[model samples]
Structures are given as structure tokens and as C-alpha cells.
Target: MDDTSFLGSYTVGTDAGMCCLWQPEHFAHVTSYDVWEDALGNDPAIERSIEAGAFVPLYLHSDGVYQVTLRTGARTPREKRYTTASSEPYLLVSKGAVALSGIEAVGADLDAAETIALAPGRYAVEVHLIDWQAEPGSTDADGNAVDGALPDFVVEISPEPDPAPPYRRTVETFDLPEE
Candidate 1:
């Protein structure tokens, strides 16, 4: 079967619902964009390909974020589609600390607290999707969404860790009046 491990997929009702919930491994250097304005409309050159069922993955190098947008006419039903993959972003660990770990939807807004802290070190990280495979009928015989394999990411920490952020203490002294 084709590999869709790096792609997120789901179907929404006519009322515009979410397809799936996916939490990116790291939150640093993450930013959001408007699908209609930024991805599809920004570049008029790629308009033809996009309309031809091309779901391109947009990479934001500076922000360390990746986005894939799918747009369908109101008449055309939304369906799952797989596109090309690129260099995925990773969590950067410099200081010996990570801040957060929690479930988040793919298109949900992210904040500073979305990060997880780890021991101070240098690392290269990879992200993966979890058990979110939809059954043929969208439910198991018992009438529950099928749970796929456990999703997890990997990280390689370096022995020679970078120095932590610099620190400077301030000192204040007052001269007493001499009698």
C-alpha cells in the first residue's frame, strides 16, 4: 500500500468540519497561513496545477512549518488525497528544558506553551502520525472508530550539547552617609 504516514486526512460535513486531529512534534518556529489567500491565491502561476487536483505541500523554512491545502468546489465532495513530502520540521532543544506535551488538532491555533521541554542538549527530531485510520465504514463492527498503530516521533541527542542561554546578574549598592 502507499505510504501516507506523513500526510493528515479526514472528511468533513457540508458545514465545514475538521478531518482529523494531529499534533506536530515541535511547536517552535510555527506559524499559520490562510489557505485561500496565501497558498492558492498568492501564486497565480500554480493556479492551473492546483485546480488539477494538485495538493502541494508548502514549506516555510524560516518558520519551520509545513502546510498542505485542499480546496474543492462547493459541489465537489471533499476526499482524502496524498501529495509529495518534504523535509519535516523538528523540535530544537538548546537549554535543558521542554515546556509542553498535549493533544492538538492539525489546523488548530498554536501558542508558545505548545512545546515540550527536554534535557538541555542538541537533537535532530522527526514527527509521525498516530492511530487515526478510518475504517471502510468509518466504524468498526462494534461501532467505534478504528484505532491504528501508535504514532511516535524520533530524536537523536548530541553528546556535545550547545551552551545554555547566557546569564547576567545585576548588583545594586547604596553608599551610607559617613558620620
Candidate 2:
């Protein structure tokens, strides 16, 4: 029997080249620039966490609106033409929900945003990169031909045990890019 179940799906937009699923309460102080410069920062630990599925970073090649689908299951979905970029664990702490938005939209009013409700705990997130232009005549479910466009991603969130220590992140400082 298939244990996977669809939770929700959303079309999120980003202008900062990245989007993330975060516990709003824990990220109240996050600035627009902090998302990439501080949280990601190209540090080895951060990279390791990303590999271990401990920190969820949805990095995009370029900025635009993309489809994000959420699901709960033990097995990751196997897409014939898509690439499984990475799957990592994210330690989510919240009253009972999490917010999905572009880094620039973090602290804004998200009441109407794509907020996912879940029991506070650890969850595994998998990012799948889809390149529709790679295949000629390929089109998304909506029948739109996004030729030569940046890749879109699908994130899967599932409950997981706490990851081992030393996998924690220390947000390092970095120079913000000139706008």
C-alpha cells in the first residue's frame, strides 16, 4: 500500500533567488538579506546539514514563481524526468504551523500566505528540480510551455527523528550583495 499522502501545494514567488519553509516565530528577526547571506552563507556545516536533511534550503538558479508541493511519506516520489537535487532534515519548532514564502516575505503578514499546519518536530524535506525546457514539447500540467526557464522545485516534508548533534548550524556573518 502507498503510504504517501498529499498535504498541500502552492505556487510561491521569489525575487531573492531563494525560498524557505520556516517557523515564523523563530524567524521574526530575519531580514530580507539574511536569508541568503547569513542562513546559507556557503559554510561547510550548512552544506553538511543540507546533505543530512537537517536544514531546508530551497536554492533557485534564478528568481520567479514556482510550484511547491508538500507531502508526507516514507518514500520519495520518483519522477522519470526530474532530478532529485537533495533531501534534508529540518528541525521545525512551532506552536503547530510553519510558513512557506520567499526570503523577502518572511516577516510580512502571512495570514493569507501558504502556511502549513503540523505538529512541532523534525521533518525531512526533499527538493526536486524540474527543467521543462530540457525536453522538447514538454509542458507542465497547466499546459504552459516554460521554455528555457529556470528550474522549479517540489519539497516533501515528513516526520523524522532528531538528527545527531554537531549538525546544528551557527549562522555566520557574510557581506550582503549590492542591490
Candidate 3:
């Protein structure tokens, strides 16, 4: 059995859950699963690469319409792609109204740097928006200039490559502290 916690701890380390292509029928009794991708490497390929990768941006019971398009510097899909997980610290507001919580990432490629599973409550999640001062450019998928004002972009937690980030994690079995 995997005993894990999302609330980060300074005294110890974290063990990113293992992500595998397991057959569903083999584990029918399993309530849920945690499928972690490769370790958050030294540097996420998305940080500097100009490839625009698309994915399910927000966290929820069911993934919504894919509206999150990361890496805005790419001109084509094959030029840059979403190959692995990103360690970038994106704002993760609790879905319910709560002061603190632990949100553990379960997908094959997802995580919140520190352990902060959400507590039982409500929260309006929204990434802190960033006002970047840059040149104004209008362009379409066909590489044509368009007329419109770019909305302020949010600064995300820079993601690292599949290589493990600067951290240590492992699965250990031990006696639990007595109440």
C-alpha cells in the first residue's frame, strides 16, 4: 500500500507517485490511482523551448475543454510538444473556501511542488495574473498578423524535464505514530 501526503515537509522528502500503463481490469477494486511521469528533470523542456503545447490546464474531478496552450513561442505543433511534466509553480487556489489544503497530483504528468492537498471546503482557483511588458504582435495560425490586444498572461511555476528535479523521494513502509 502507498502511504503518501501532499502537505510538504522540510524534515523529509517527497515520493512522486509512479505512473504506469496498467490494465484497468487487473485492479478493479482500486478506488483511484496516481500515475506520475518521469521525474521533474533539471529543466523542463517547455521553459525555454518555443513549442506551444496544449493540455488540460486546470485541476478538477473531470477535465474540462482543453483551453490551456502553453509555450507560446512555437509556430507549429511538431516544432515543440508537451513531452513530460512541468514543475513550474502555477497558482492553485483551493476549489472551495478554505485557508489551507493539500493537493496531490495523480496524473502521469502533474504535481504541486509542495504538498498542499486541499482541505474540506471551497476555493476559487485562479492563477495570479502577470503583466508582461512587451511588443504588440498580432498573428493567426496561418502566420498572419491579427488585430487585438493580448490579455495579461499568468506566470506559471517553471516546469522541469522528465529528469528528477533537485529533490529526493521514495516509498517507505513503517509504523504509524500512535494517537
* Best-fitting candidate, scored by TM-score: 2
**Stretches > 4 Å off in candidate 2:** 1-4, 29-55, 74-81, 132-137, 140-151, 162-179
Error of 1 at 163 (Å): 17
Q: Show model 3 residue runs off by greater than 4 Å.
A: 1-105, 108-112, 133-179
Q: Weakest 10 consecutive residues, lDDT, candidate 1?
A: 166-175
Q: What lDDT tens digits, residue by residue, belong to model 3 across residues 62-179?
A: 3211112122122122212321222233222232211111112322222222223343321212222122223235356675435432222211222233452332111111122379
Candidate 2, residue 14: how far the Cα is off, in Å: 0.7
lDDT of 1 by residue, 1-179 (tens): 22322222222111111111122333222345343234323335223322221211121112222222211111111121211121232323335443222212222243422333344554333222222233245457776555542112112222332553221111101122379
lDDT of 3: 0.23
Q: Model 1: how far is 1 from its true place, Å?
A: 24
Better of 1 and 2 by TM-score: 2
- Give candidate 2's error at residue 158 in angstroms: 1.7
RMSD (CA, Å), each prediction: 21.5, 7.3, 19.8
- For residue 146, model 1's alpha carbon misses the true position, in angstroms, by 5.4
Best by lDDT: 2
- Compute the lDDT for candidate 1: 0.26
Quote the positional error of residue 49 for candidate 3 in Å. Answer: 29
lDDT of 3 at 117: 33
